[model samples]
Target chain A: MNLAFTEIQETIRMVQMESLDIRTVTMGISLRDCIDSDFDSMNNKVYEKITSYAGQLRPVAEQVEKEYGIPIINKRISITPVAELLGHASKDQAVQLAKTLDKAARDLGVDFIGGYSALVHKGITKGDQTLLEALPEALSVTERVCASVSVATTRTGINMDAVKQMGEIIKEASELTKDANGIACAKLVVFCNPVEDNPFMAGAFHGTGEGEAVINVGVSGPGVVLNALKRHSDADLGEISEVIKRTVFKITRAGEMIGRVVAERLSLPFGIMDLSLAPTNAMNDSVAEILEEIGLERVGTHGTIAALALMNDAVKKGGAMASSYVGGLSGAFIPVSEDNGMIKGIEDGALSLSKLEAMTCVCSVGLDMIALTGDASASSLSGLIADEMAIGMINKKTTAVRVIPVPGKSEGEMVEFGGLLGRAPVMGVNPFSSEKLINRGGRIPAPLQALIN
Target chain B: MEQKRAVVSVVGKDQIGIIAKVTTCLSENKMNVLDISQTILQDFFTMMMIVDVSEAEDLAKLHDDLDKVSQELGLKIDIQLEDIFQTMHRI
Candidate 1:
């Protein structure tokens, strides 16, 4: 046989038993040209552009899945940040644009449509202000529209004003959807050093620099990595890193192949392959379990950071070797609600909010999908964002905050968001007030590393 | 002409008429089996077949046909493009 029997079985086992699959095949359609002076005209253009470019995204992805026999979990679309298209529009118009995007996603049968976003890391323009003001309404009314705001960058520093406003916006968004356990908050994220080519949602947006349209794919295989580690349980740390790298390399290669084929079928350009080990709420498909298999009793213990760092580093090393172009936030994702082990870690009292904050320093994204008490002050939320932004600014890595404060839910209670968003235990926040720091509304100066030129 | 190949795998308890049923369906669909290997691991029969699907009319229909055969034989059968295995296991 051209392929050994074991090789064939290995691929089958990865998909059938270990849950190896592509998380998303996101089509990035640039909408910079969809802007118009009239709000209705602009909305129509946006709708037409997205539907035309992505109308076949779902069917084509399904065809490829059948042919290749690799399950593709999501087919999504990300567009140019809506703030850029809102120059001639108002706050109401921003929400209207979100409605337009929602319709396009529904008509096309895509899972979610991202890029209802604003990039205000440096300062908020009139357009950015309108989008921020409309976020709560826009998110509350839409079923499939996801939004993100980038408030800090290493070169631009932290926008304290935007950070403060986002804290209020998060609270309002949660309150508006209070009946659904603050589900709206699950579709909104606040980012620092946000990537433009991310294929994963609530944060993916087609960058201004991208072409008219491109296809980016995100590969997820936490289960495959965990199973491989279990096979080499007796191996030392160096050997463990090697095992992770090899597994990542194989999965990344598969992702690249799928992405290129999908691009060819759509007659679009093949963009980067995001090699993120995004975990789901399924058993054996967890990043925390991989860390535990690496010798931690739980995910939030003292050695968790070191284990995560090694895994993140090895993923990049192997993924780089496998793909010619790999971008987005590529590392282990630690969303507390989405991964079974993380939920268990929180329930077992080993994972705390502060511990999660520290882990984000080494992982891919920041305090993702965490639930806070209803009484958590907006100032405390701003304080949490500020702290995570500082880590991203100083470390020059992409970080984000997507915390939900469930209305009428207190600490130690569970709020179910259901589906891929999963349920999270409401964790307590520090009682100490951050009002003093959050009240000072100005930008934090750029970090010393920003002068790399 | 270069042949487009796919892998057809079957796993179940060893039983009579399993191979005959699968090969009959492939010939009916104009798909030729290039090579095959079967083994009994942990008391379950496993078989891997590389088949030339280039001349086949419809891959989806063939998949459906094999699915029906699997149900009748009480086995799990899967057919996938060989490119997936080549891309993953081979550099």
Candidate 2:
């Protein structure tokens, strides 16, 4: 046999038992050519372009899954930012475009379609202002249209005006969808230094620099890494990192192969493969569980950041070598609601909002899928977003906030958004005021490059 | 014709006609078995076969036929292209 029996069995065990699977295969379609001065004409062009480009995305992904025997969890589409297409368009026109996108998603049978976005890190343009104004209505009215806004970058510092507006927008989105536990907020992300080719949502978007269309893959398997760590329980931290690297290398190889084949079948250029360890509500498949397997009593205890820093670096090192093109937020994700172990950590009081903030400084994206009390002030939300943005700006990494303030829900209460969005316990926020700081609506100066400390 | 191969794996209890039933289905579908290995590990039977299905008329139907045989024999049978294993294990 060309392959050893043990090697074959190891692959089987990883898939059948450890919840190893390709997280998503997202097709990035460029809608720049769909723009027109007339709003309805632009909406029709956008709809036709996306539907035509991604018509075979689901069927092709399913065929590849069958051939490879690996489960591809999601087949999604992302497009150019809607702000780019909203030339002299009204807020109602922005909402109309979102509805068009939602209809396309339903017709194509994709669960979520991202890139209803605006980029205003330095200053908001007229189109961006219109899109931001339409966010609450557009998000609440659509079923599968995901939206995002970039309010900060390493070079641009933080746009305090956009940040403050997004806080109010999130609140209105949740309030409008109170019947569904604020599901509208679950589909919105506020970002700082967001990536261009991210295949994960509600953060994924096709950057302006990308080609006409491309296929990007996100590989997930925290459960596989957890099992590998358990098998080498007695190893030192250095040895433990080696174990993680090797396991990540194998999984990345599998993911790249699947992605390339999918792209080849569609006759589109293959984009980057995201080497992120995204967790789900499944038991033993949690990134927090991987931390616990690394000898943490719990995920948010002291020394958690150190352990996470080590693990995140090792994952990048391994995945970088495995795939030629790697992009997206390719780090360990610790969404509070998405990972079952994280939910347990929150319930047991082992994890707090503050600790999660600290952990994001050393890991992947920031404050993902968190739930806050209904009465949490918009200024506080803006403050939380600013703090996260500062970290990403200073460190030159991508970070984002996707929080849901479930209306009429208090701290310690739970709300369910179901399936992938998962359920979250409404946690209390700091009861201080950031109204004065948010009221000073000007750009925070970009940091200096000479600071070594 | 280009050569395309698949890995067919069967895992279950050691039972009568396990090999006979599996190979018969492959032959009926014109899939040639290039290499095979079977072992009893901890009182359970595990089998791995590398098959060339490039000449098969309908691959999906062959998969369905093998699925039926697996159900009758009370085992788990999965067929995946050999490229998946080669991509992971080799490079």
Candidate 3:
């Protein structure tokens, strides 16, 4: 037979029975040329460039989806960090540029436009400060603009000053959008060692080193992995890892193919395929469920981290074998709100903030899509970020924090951000203050790992 | 020129004329069925057809026509380009 019947059936089962999908086709457009001292002209250029480049993104993605019969969930755009273009601009100008980005995203029919961002790991420049100051207001005012701030890296250690300010900025962002349960904070991410070409938001952005325009794809298949593991339920961990690796290889291959098609249609350069098992709120599509299927009683139990480490490593190994360009946080994503199983784990008293933090040490992204008490102190938030950042710094891996302090909501209360963003139960934060430690406001010097060079 | 191939998958409860109706739609759309397989597992019908759609004027229209037949027969149908299956499942 030219095509094996079983193979065709298996592919159909993966897409139809399981919820395998291409999570996003993100176009990263460089806005470095949009820079101007005149904020208005710069904003116009940014909008024009994004609209021109990404105008056909949705139609092309839809056509590809129809042709391939694979669900392409989101068509998004990421740009050069807005801060880089705000060198001589004021805080108000930064906010205006953010609005321009929001308008561009809407015009292009994309779900989100990231890169309202600043990389302040070493120290904050004047432009970085302005962007940081405008983050809370910009996020609150815009619907589709996503923001990220890089506050730590392996080469240059954590910037405690920016970390401290980020705590306040997060609080302000939450309070400003308190009526909607601080949904704005859900669109913001704080990262240590942010990748240059992540296709996922709220961390996607075209980095300084990327080309003029590039198309990156993110593939999601926690359900596919879970289904694969189910077939080998009695297998040992080594064999289980093998199953995961094989499954990831297939998923990554599909993503790379779709990415090539999309980039070719758009006449842009293909960047990378991010092979992440990103879960949705849909049932049976949870990373936590995959962990549970690996013989854990629940997601946050004793063997959870080890199981996640196995899966993450196996995914990367398989993805590396499948695609030459595997960038972004290419492993299992454990976003609390976005995964139904994680929410169940939290509701069952099996998962806690500390436990999730520990799991982040082994997973792709860190402390993502978690919600905190409305009254959680800024010091505690900063301390939590500092801890996650330290893990990334010491281990030299990417880690991020996207905790939303949903105003007027207490621990165990539900805060719904509607479709895709999902609903998160406000998890409790440490009551004690870390003000003294956070207020030190100096760079946490690079760890010994930095000496590898 | 090489024929443009597609996979037409139909799934539903087992019933008579499932294959006949699907092939009629494909023929009306000027698609030639290259390979076909059907199975009945405990009264559930599942079939896969590798069809050459090069002569079909509009692939999307053919898809919609097949979908309309699938709905009338109370079945789920999907028409996917062959490349998706080959690229993903093959090395």
Best-fitting candidate, measured by DockQ?
Answer: 1
lDDT of 3 by residue, B1-91 (tens): 7988999998898887988999999999899999999887567788999999889899788878988898899999999999888987777
Name the runs in model 1 displaced over 4 angstroms: none
Candidate 3 lDDT over A238-327, as tens digits, reads 999999999999989988999999999989989999999999988799999999999889889899999999999999999999999999
- At residue B90, give the lDDT of candidate 1: 87
- Candidate 3: deviation at residue A53, Å? 0.5
Of the two candidates 2 and 3, the one with more favorable DockQ, higher being better, is 2
Total backbone clashes of candidate 1, pairs 3 or more residues apart or in separate chains: 0
Query: lDDT tens digits, residues A1-453, model 2?
Result: 399888888888899889999999999999998888888888899989999999999999998998888999999999999888897999998999999999999999987899999999999999999999999999999999999999999888999999999999999999999999889998999999999999999988899999999999999999999999999989999999999999999999999999999999999999999989999999898999899889989878888888899899889988998998999888898899998888888888999999999988988899999999999999999999999999999989888999999899999998898888889889999999999999999999888941445
Error of 1 at B8 (Å): 0.9
Ranking by lDDT: 1, 3, 2
Predicted model 3 interface RMSD: 0.9
Could you tell me which residue pairs clash in candidate 1?
none
Arrange candidates by TM-score, highest first: which order?
1, 3, 2
lDDT of 2 by residue, B1-91 (tens): 8879998999998999998999999999999999899999899899999899899888778879988999999998888898999989896
RMSD of 3: 1.0
Off by over 4 Å in 3: none
What's the DockQ for every one of the candidates? 0.87, 0.82, 0.81
Against the true structure, candidate 1 reaches a TM-score of: 0.99
